[model samples]
Target: GLGPEECMAVNPRLVYGRMTGWGQSGPLAPRAGHDTNYAAVSGALWGCSPADARPVSPFAVLGDIGGGAMYLMTGLLSGIVQARATGRGTVVDAAIVDGSAHMLNLMLSARQSGLVADVRGQSIHDSAPFYDTYVCADGHYVTVGAIEPQFYTLLLQVLGLAEDPDFTGSQWDKAAWPVRRARLAALFLAQPRAHWQALLEPTDACFGVVLSPVEAAQHPHMRARDVYSERQGVLQAAPAPRFDGAAYEPGEACAPGAHTQSVMEGLGQSGARAVWRQR
Candidate 1:
């Protein structure tokens, strides 16, 4: 049964299964919008980029997957475990806004400590060019995550800039990050992604190619791990959280009325299709 227009009363396990961005019922819950809009309302999308342009769309993954459905699913599972142990079931109120706010706990701490500015892309991790993406010669991109001293050293070494005076002198000193980042950006632009990958993949330098969506599915590492599969001419995601010593299978899709008879009988309602036909 549905609850209060926005909420719904289902199995505590299933109640934990529903997903939405604005969540079941908040001030903005009834408003219809997409992930970007939903994220904006929950402080998940404020000044998320450079001050010059519109916000980038990172897809529905943030609101729908991260804040909404995934957390609900997790809560549901946890609730099931709790109920089994306590012999009591309860409802789960999964609100995307609440979840999204919870997701910002790290940043909240930073903010409270005055470490993070009230501005976006101004902090060390967000604004620091030392850990960001750069375009490559092949129209692709590469990520440089030289966040720490050792990793940054590995980056300089692999880039053949080991002999550069600034490479070792003032790394991680904040002031030098801009200069180092500029140098690294230029160096990355000079080579294709594959060239950098070949050199850095074996080293401690945390470098990687910024692959396209299609490239991710057939990537060598993903294929080696069997991270995805195809069935009945449809590409379906693999089941997550593999069972402990048990096999898992996806339920078959059934038509809407496929279980109507069974459900009605279970509910003690008398509406058998065969009996109706006899009348």
Candidate 2:
């Protein structure tokens, strides 16, 4: 197979970007793996699920796109800038395991500050009563992340629990978390998700209702910003991070290899068309 060395031999200033689940020279480099495998080895999957539950894989978001594609793009861009300045290229070995582990730096910092714990279900994110998801009477879910005292106070006030003795104590008291969680769960379960949404969505309780993709598309904020669009009967997300607040219009989707001939011609490799057609 043609590799970076061969490509760089042809063009000394070409940026060579490689993506893999492990790495090019590691023991597991040649092993077949996927997003979950990479994230598992990187320790990013451990804190994802609740304590005693199976670690839930976040589809391809964690390893494939977040760790693999994004890092590769960044490396390629940086390599381009350096190559233009130094008249030499570099290889970007973007391994999912490496990028995923690097993404945990924020969590590592939190751990040092005592906001996170080594044990599962013991951290503020996973264990706090005010920070987890609750099931409503309609079987739908709502999430809260009132970690700060002010937000927690607002949450308790909206829930009519501000004066309750069980919650008037220190918010970080681990001993009281279990009982508080149970109470909050019961309270939420007594009302439908919409009811809580109406009561808390306007406040600074740091609250939100769990929404599906289709539902999210219909959300007021999303609709106002045109976050999702439909083309040829297919729903897709619009280009993000708009430039100068200008919306980007996406082109129609094309079939695989739709522009292969044009690309080959542009690269002065028109003769390769015949070779590719023979296959």
lDDT of each: 0.70, 0.91
User: Candidate 1 lDDT (Cα, whole model)?
Assistant: 0.70
lDDT of 2: 0.91
Error of 2 at 20 (Å): 0.4
Candidate 2: segments with Cα more than 4 A from true spot: 271-279
Q: Candidate 1, 269: how far from true, in Å?
A: 9.9
**Stretches of candidate 1 exceeding 4 Å from the true structure:** 1-18, 47-52, 110-115, 243-279
Q: Give the backbone clash total of model 1.
A: 0
Residue 239 error for model 1, in Å?
Answer: 2.9
lDDT of 2 at 250: 73
Alpha carbon lDDT of residue 59, candidate 2?
54
> TM-score per candidate, in order?
0.77, 0.93
